[model samples]
Target: MNKELQKLLRQINDKKNEVKSLVNDGKLDKARAAKEELKALQEKFDLLFDLDEEEHEGIEDKVSRGTAKVIGGEKADKKNLVKSFVNIIKAGFLHVEPDEADVKVYKDALTSDATPNDEGQQGIGVTIPEDIRTDIIELRRSSDNLEQYVNVEGVTTKTGTRNIEVDAESTPFDNVDEAADFPEMDEPVFEPIEYKVKKKGGILKMTAELLEDTAANIMAYINKWIAKKTKATRNAMILKVLNTMTVGKEVVVSNLDSLKDIFNEQLDPAVAATSIVITNQSGFNFLDKLKDSDGNYILQKDPTLQTKGKLLFGEYPIVKLSKKTLKSKQILAEDGTTVTGYKHPVFCGDLKEAITLFDRNVLTIDINDKGSGMWEKDLTGIKVRDRFDVQPVDKGAVIKGEITEVVNG
Candidate 1:
């Protein structure tokens, strides 16, 4: 066959293999897309093959004038020619037998300008399908997603300010005598915090060939990757704010009285009632092993709900973070040896009142394959942008406590 016809046939075979692979893998959605592409390629190949045959009509007639026989000994017309070609291709894919007329036409087409293989065999190009699984494996995200603890405020503008009453609790109205002169009272002080949404994103470039040939949903995969990245970014930002907050009280994990003081004396009664303990794995390990004078574990399961897991002091909920997410610090011991210490932050109190996330609530995605550089390189660029800001709101509402090894100097 001519070079163009040969190239078209190769594409058709490749597409067929792709469809079979996707079906075996259980990726039905991608398999459907591949099947559609395969059908278009097959149609194009048929059209090109018909044109090629027409160009060699005289040679074809000479070769098939007597030997070629239709189903009913009828002359092979244009309709039969196309039908026979399609039937041969379908029979090859389905592993079934085609009509005698289709087999005769298929053999004639293969002999017309065909090249010999390495084994000196002609008309031998077939793809065998393989088994594939349907599900995709993905990385697990950090369980201590800090966004769930903090307050999220959606804003339309890029920059804005929020006013918080700083001393609302401290400044209270004084009782006035009946019809007597009112006592002078302190006015509530407000602190204005400014917030500007910061943009974070990245771009992924892929080859045009992979986009067309791959059985997986490339766009969906990219989108899922972006979502994961954005979640990690937000988690880091929230932790940064929480780590920098002023500590209301520091409690030594080994001292049971100090831990009790955190709730009774350090934090307000109302705040302590709705408090939670946030710590890393190492910190949780220490608390989990703590025992009362009775030799019973301090960190007991929630009495109200057994399925709610263990709680701190059987009162406050515990939000255990992974070591990677919470991070650790290097400290010098008294002997001048460096040691890794996980700063298990025990953030007790109302977390929502401590931090606020100003979210623009807009995630923009732009895809470009027509740009000059991209077109020349045959690459498609997928760009994503996420806008949000994390800031401390009521610092006093959350008290920070660190559980770490005693650094002897």
Candidate 2:
């Protein structure tokens, strides 16, 4: 199957170049014929790549709670509460001496589930107040991969295992006749993915002057930093899991011709109908350069244009990552020369079915205004932690393409 697809793509690319040259030389008739041939080949490729959603039951439907869309519902007002909390924390760090009412506002924002301190106060160690937790969660959701691809679950406990049914039922349904033999029934395979809370944090050093500058939008600055660090940490972990998944299909493409083959093959018809091609910005830039022999861009923009700025390769949406993210492992040329840069991996398929993420949902923060050694320096320490794991449940749904510099042209 791969060999056939590869051959077909090479033919298209070759024909495209030929048609362009023919038209440039005023051979309109020849160009038209070649264009017709290209059209036929494209139709065939599309047929092979078109996945029937009814035939392939998505793994997410089996056990996914959908991606988290924080900052909605009855808790909409929590958005402001979160900002208020940040302001209170900023005051503490700067010794700004906020009013008694301000302290109460920050404390009151703690989550209901927060373990009370000895003084029966809300939350532990200046942790993100409950109302503000939504903001943090929403920020984490901004991770390029986490919210888009992974099956995000909001779990309550810090340590636990997610029991997932890995396999579909093996029995075939058959019509029964009077006293017909019964078909054998099989149970789905269940597996547990254990997740532990991992700590990720950063300390912001505020100058006494900046802290004391009441006019400064310190809350916004702190919030942006919090969101940035949170996404970086969580997305890194998500990438780790995705890059290692047992891809159901893979193709090595050294040139545009072969790249198209791999791209088509990755769109498995057995998976869900909605699919996305994941690549970094550099990889997308390479794709952007792909042109038909007629000098028209081969990559099509999404016709509907309602995909939140997602471009399309045929019907599949492309999710562009930041530069260097989604990188392929190092490669060596056939002549034994080392490939200098990363061959960014182009991941494509029904990501919702391909990856599962277990999120503990709670962002725990521990603040130390006076650590044993820090008291002397008057440094305030903020520690944040969250629990989550990204795992592949249906590896067959994903296809990977390791793209190197050779494919750029």
Candidate 3:
């Protein structure tokens, strides 16, 4: 799937250049055709790459929660919340701060579980612990329905879910809006018993321990989030903007091609602008901003937290963000780079220029600016192993050497 997206990217870059060249050459007809073709290709490409919704049919689905905009009623929300909670697992926020004092930094296990068999086995989901939750704040809708979540935790990686309560005399049809709607089952279909996390220590103790691993773990989780969020947020934002733009006429954008190119540009300068500086300077200079009156970074108040689908920034970034949106507005990082918005630094420009700016002169672009990972891109995935699957040699075996001509000094 990725290989195909890369191919589509090449086709897009080629077509974009071709259209520009044709326009200069006075081939209006060809240019128009190219534009139309580009639109079609982009639609197909986005469909392949877009990550707004989880693919329930695949392994990714069991591990991934469908889009963040989970549908709801009484029963629907409960199901969707469970699904979203699963995504939190994949998002790596489920592995909350353990009371392990010896460790300075920790990472969530990236393995996941799917379809538990009768023997207590199933395909692995993302490698989060069996219980990422420490404590659950419970809420109730009625006598039979109850919801649980953690509100003031270090991160907002949890989904609100209603537990379906059952009494000895209650039948499955007791909660249904109308039993005639679906005669699929004769008895109540109770959901599995879900557990809420319990804290291992007091607030202060947990705070101190979580801070120990905050710098490294936060960066890792947030980076993965941008990739995942950008795909989802862009889709939602565009749909929202479209809804706002047309005001109900269902009118497409004034320039559909340009809109897509920008939305699917893969490098949203806006997001890069937010996190680049923060990532580099996260720990020392900017941690204060995330801190509240109690001198704690709001997001790091707990260990089992990750801010979902939102990019957070420091107050100083307000002056830099000249656009309508001010500091800390929910934004997507350009590309899937691990940028710390409030502390680290990011550079955004032309793809060629961005590479030169971000990597400086040290790195070389092997594929040139030929379409990169343009479609069906997997922004976030668990980093279980230290090295990539493509890295052939053993880790320690790889060496870095440079040829140097001996000069008589």
Please give each candidate's TM-score: 0.56, 0.64, 0.18
Candidate 3 per-residue C-alpha lDDT over 197-290 given as tens digits, one digit per residue, 9 for 90 to 100:
2211100001223323534353344334333332232223322322232233221222224223323343344423322211122221232344
**Top-TM-score structure, candidate number:** 2
lDDT of 1 by residue, 1-409 (tens): 4456556665665565567556755799998998899789778866765675554564456448764444442435544444454444334323354444554454333311112121421222221111100011123133466777789986645677889998676777889889899987777789998899898877666675555432334434554576567778888898888878854455555556668888998888877888888887877887888888999998988777646467878898888878888775556555767664445666677888888999765554444454458768877665556779999998878777777765453
| RMSD vs true structure, all candidates | 19.0, 24.9, 28.3
Candidate 3, after superposition: displacement of residue 180 in Å? 92
Question: How many backbone clashes does every candidate have?
Answer: 2, 2, 34
Model 1, runs deviating above 4 Å = 1-143, 176-184, 204-220, 247-251, 303-308, 334-337, 340-343, 368-381, 406-409
- Pairs in steric clash, model 2: 110-130, 111-130
**Which portions of model 3 miss their true places by more than 4 Å?**
24-26, 43-56, 59-409
Candidates, ranked, TM-score = 2, 1, 3
On lDDT, the candidate that comes out on top is: 1
lDDT of every model, 2 decimals:
0.63, 0.58, 0.28
Model 3: lDDT of residue 105: 11
